[model samples]
Structures are given as C-alpha cells and as structure tokens.
Target: MTDWQVHALKYADRNSRTRAESFIFDDNHDAPHAMDYFIWVLRRGAEVILVDCGYDSEEATRRGRPILRDPRDALAGIGLKAEDITQLIVTHLHYDHAGGLHLFPNATIHLQEAEMAYATGPCMCHDTLKMPFTADHVCEAVKRVFQGRCVFHDGDAEVSEGVTVHCLGGHSRGLQAVRVRTEAGWLCLASDATHFYENVFENKPFPIVVDLQNMLDGFARLHELASDRSLIIPGHDPLVTTLFPQDGPEFCWRLDRGPSGDFNL
Candidate 1:
C-alpha cells in the first residue's frame, strides 16, 4: 500500500464551559472543556496535502476565540510553506475551518458538492444554519470555483494513491473526513464528524448538527474506514496531542508513527 506521513498542526485553543448534553445529545452535564483547533498535513515523498486552512487572528477575535499563532506560521513550524501547498481538502466552509484559504495562493481545493450548495444556497437563509459559517469564507470558496481551483466530490473519492476523502455530511451539508494509509495503518482524520473521541466511541452527537441521523451514522462509517479505533483521530480533542508523539517543542504531532500512548477508549 502507498504510505504517507501525517502531521496535526495545532494553531489555537480555547477553554469554555460546555454542557455535556450539548456534546452528547439528550445527556446533561455542565462542565468546562478545552477545544483545540488544528490543520493537518499529509506528505508522501514530495507531495503535500493539507486538510483544512485554519482561521486567522481576525477571525479568532471576531469569534471570541483566542489566537495562539497564525496557521500559516504554524505550518511553517512543520517545514511547510503555505504558498507551496498545491492540494488542500476543505472539510467544510465553517469559519474556523475555511477562513484561511487565501493563504494558499496555488492550491486546488477539494470539497463535497453538497457543502458548496449548502453554504451558498437556501439552507444558509436560516440563522441557525448560517451561524457556523462566515459569508466571506463561503464566498472565497465560490471564487475558487470560478478560478477553476475547486474540485467538488459527490461522495467518497481518492485524493491520491492512499488518501481518500469520504463525504459524510452530518455536521454540515457536505462535511467530509480524510482516510490516509500511513506506516501505523489507515488513519481517519475525523474532522468535525466527531470533535472528540468520546463523541464517536460513545455515539454522542455534537450539538451543532445538520442531520442527526447522518451524524450518528458517520460514527459507524469512521470505525469502518479506519484501520482500528486507535488510528482514528478526532478533530478538536486535546487528547490527540497527548496521545500522539509530538514532532518537537512545536505544536505538530507525527501521525505516521504509532501513537505514543495506548488508546484509552
């Protein structure tokens, strides 16, 4: 099988009071939680593919989330220059995930066809549905489509030899997860499909969901696609950084290698 090195580059984090019920549907437990924001890089020899373009400082301030560092700068810490990135997978067009697309001047963005429609169509007319997205970010993606830099996928598609994007729209109309063949095994990057390991392992749906049934089904899909439960990486969990081996003092974690710790779940 073709193999690639995967790295999770964390750019910012926030501490907030979250009701457990909000994360796990129908269960109530108010408490504090830490949410981390990250962008992933998959490298196979000379080829590089980025998962998401994290939000900038302005976005952080606008959203009331703290900015640790610019995502482009964070990518640099992992030896990747934003301008050189030619391929990117946008999981969704939410402000936090798609806000920094302009940084990659020469990149072909891969997105789910449903996602583009959801972001630009009538669904966004609802305040609840539109709250998670930034119009400017969605517009940027539209511009990319016009520029011939956007590749829309209807469902599961191979991005390269060992990397595939699975369209599992639950969190958003076109949210997708990346499955990568790595030295450790197939690592499924569950970007927002599950924000934390508990969300999947416990079958708990995150509160902000477009389709509850699909969100529940997505958990099962993630398990089916990953090599094992341990190889599945949740999108915003701080435990990911703790479980995987860090690349150095930097915020990047090496995902191609087996995790440093045993899977707690």
Candidate 2:
C-alpha cells in the first residue's frame, strides 16, 4: 500500500487583493498571505481520508477573497470526485474549511463535537469567535448528522491506521489538526488551528481566535506531537510550496519526507 498522497486543493489565495493584518504577528509589518482550504488525501491500501473541503468560489468572492483556482479542479487532477471520497476530517466549521461539504456525498465526516456546538451556539456573538465561521455551513453539518454521515469526537481519536486527530479548541471550538504516519514519515496538518508557521514559531495567536489560551496551548501541543517540526504544515502559510518540493509545473505542489525530529524553516 502506498503511504500518503496530498494535493493542493486551493480555492483561494491572497493575491494582492486585500491586506490582512490579522494573520500576521504584532511586531511584523509584513503581509502574511494564505491559501483558503483543500483536502488532504491520506491513502493506505483502499482506505482514504480527506481533511477539510475548500469553499465555493462565489462565497469567497462575496467575502472579497481572491480566488486563485477552483478546488474541484485540483481534485480532478488527482482523479477524485466528491462521491469517491471515503472519509472526511473537518478541522473546523468555518465556511472556508467546511463549505464544500455538499460536494462529498459518500464520505463519513469526522468532526469535534464541541466544534459543532460552538458554530451553532450563541457564543458566535463575540467578535473574536463569530468572524471565522458561517452559520449556514454549521447548519448543514448538523443536518448531515441525521443522515448518519457525521462522526463526532470530543478530543483525541484515531480515524484510521495512521491518522490521529487532536481536538484543539482555539481558532474555533472543536478545531482539530491531523497527524499521519506516511512512508515519508509523520506529517501533521495544522489546519486552521494555526494559520501560519510564524503563528507557532513566534507564539503569536491569529487575531480571530476565540479563546486565546486554547490557541496558545494548541501550538505547544503541535510541537509535542510533530515527529520533526518540518513535517508540521500550517493551514494558510504561502510558503508551503517553497518549503517542500514541487510535483508538477511552476504552480503545482508536492509533499516531502522527513522524521518527527526537527522543524523545517
């Protein structure tokens, strides 16, 4: 069985459109750009797991996000479709991370139960909490539960042979990151738990975080779990392609191999 295969299913990128200071550190005047969201396909034998669904282009435009490419197009390049997806791990219920849920019909979704509550609960009124999510998407996930496709977990849990999910409540309640053992080595998808590598390296929590303490704690936990810090990939870091190898043409991306020992700067 091949270990793990990941693709950059980017739905959007910050291409000189909007300046977001919220994603950067307090001391730095630099603009830290980001990729919206996409699926991480982990395959060992016939089992396949998808981490996060990229949002639709229309909504992204409505929100004034710069659309780089369509996520579905990225999936097609890998010969996959929504129904072909076996399982999905939602890092959080923010629209960018979970909006395309309508695309995957046959996959059982793994999500933090606390995340579901927070997205739908009254806590969204707080400025720090409400800005990152879309209530409509949370409502859809709730509906999927009745359809027997949602698997809710409170904390850490194993979804398959090599994938582990750690529920970290900070960027959003129930937001989790995935750690997978691959032939290359251990890879941890920081998801939205930490938007950029600088957020972890500098201990700076992204501005939209709900619980500041949880966000900081989550960063520490990521460090503890990484086989090597380099394998820990941030959710929105623009430098991911440069840090790792390129698989195709100038724009395409690829995953790299390493141990759980050191962080890749």
Candidate 3:
C-alpha cells in the first residue's frame, strides 16, 4: 500500500460550557469543553491533498471565535501554500470547515453529493439548520461547480492512492470522513462524525446533530474503518495535540507516526 504523511494543523480554539446531557445524550452536569479548529493535510511523494479549508480571520471575528492564526499561515508553517494545492476534500459545508474555499483557487474540491444538496436545498430554508453555514461560502461552492472545480461523490470514493472518503450523514445531511493509509496503519479522520474521542468512546452524540441515529452509526463505522482505536483521529479535540507528537512549535502534528503518549480509549 502507498503510505502518506498526515498532518493536523490547528488554527483556533474556544472554551465553552457543555453538559454531558447536551453532548452525550446522557444526564450529566456542566463540564468545560475545548473546541479546537483544524485542517488536515495528506502528502505522498509530491502530491498534496488538503481536508477541510479552515475559516478566515474575518469569519472568526464575526463569529466571535478568536483566531490563533490564519489557516493559510498554518499551512505555510508546514511548507505549503494555498495556491499550490490542487486537491481538497470538504468534510461538509459548515462555515468553519468550508469558508476558506477562495484560498485554494486551483484545487478540485471533492464533496458529498448529498451535502451540496443539503446546503442549497430546502433544509437551508430554516435558519436553525443554516446557522453553521455561511451563505457566501455555499455560494462560492456553487460557483466552483460551474467552474468545473467541484467533484461531487455519491458515496465512498478514492481521492488518491491509499486515501478514501466515506460519506456518513450524521451531523449534517452529507458529512463525510476520510481514511488514509499511513506508516502506522490505516487512520480514520473522523471529521465531524465524531467531534471528540469521548463522543465515540463513550457512545455520546454531540448536541448539534441533524440525525442522531446516523451519528451513532457513524461512530461504529469509524471503528470498523480504522486499523485500531488509537489510529482514529477526532475532529475538534484538544487531546489530539497532546497525544500526537508535535512537528514544530506551531500546532502541526504528524499523524503518520505513532501517538506520543497514551490516551484513554
């Protein structure tokens, strides 16, 4: 199998009060949750595949989420420039995950067909379901489709050698997760399917779910896809930085290698 280097770039983080009842579907009192924002990069030889374009500083300010640094700058820290990337996988159309679409001008954006429909379809007519998406970001994706830069996948599809995307509608109507073959083994990048390790480990669903059953099932699918529990990476957990060894001073962690320390499974 062809192996690739996986890197997680953390762009911003926020601390919020969350209860186990809200996040886990179980009754538990208040707990502090660290919501970290990140974009992933996969590299093999000279090929680069980016996953989830992180939101820009303006969106951060408007949303009241402080920016640690621009996601583009975070990519630069790992020796990559936005324009140089030719392929990107969009987990979903949420503003924080897809807002930076304009940054990668020349890249082919891969997304789930259902996601595009969900973002532009009747569900968006309600403000509650549309809160996570920025109109401009969704509109730009439509433009990309017209420009021949968007590739919509019906379900599971291979992005490159050893890298595959699986559509698992849970948090959104078309959310997907990426599985990549790494030096360690097959690592499942459980994007929003499982926002934190606890979500999967404890069988707790996040509060902002569109389909609760699908979200629970997605967790099972992640376990089935990954080589092992430790190889599965969550979407917005601070423990990712602590468990995985840092590549440098910036928030880059090399996912191709084994985790630096033990974490409760």
Q: State TM-scores per candidate.
A: 0.97, 0.89, 0.96
Backbone steric clashes in candidate 3, count: 0
- Candidate 1: 10-residue stretch with minimal lDDT: 19-28
lDDT against the true structure, each candidate: 0.90, 0.75, 0.89
lDDT of 2 by residue, 131-187 (tens): 767776777798889999899988999988778899988888789989887656777
Model 1 bad stretches (over 4 Å): 26-28
Estimate, for each residue in 87-130, the C-alpha lDDT of model 1 and write its tens digit. 99999999889999988889899999999999999998899999
| Residue lDDT tens for model 3, 4-92 | 99999999888775665338555655776668889999999889999999899888888887789888899999889999889999999
Candidate 2 deviant stretches above 4 angstroms: 17-20, 23-25, 30-37, 249-252, 256-264
Residue 82 in candidate 2, Cα distance off native in Å: 1.7
RMSD after CA superposition, every candidate: 1.3, 2.9, 1.4
Clashing pairs in 3: none
- Model 3 residue 177 distance off true place after TM-score fit, in angstroms: 0.2
Residue 163 in candidate 1, Cα distance off native in Å = 0.5
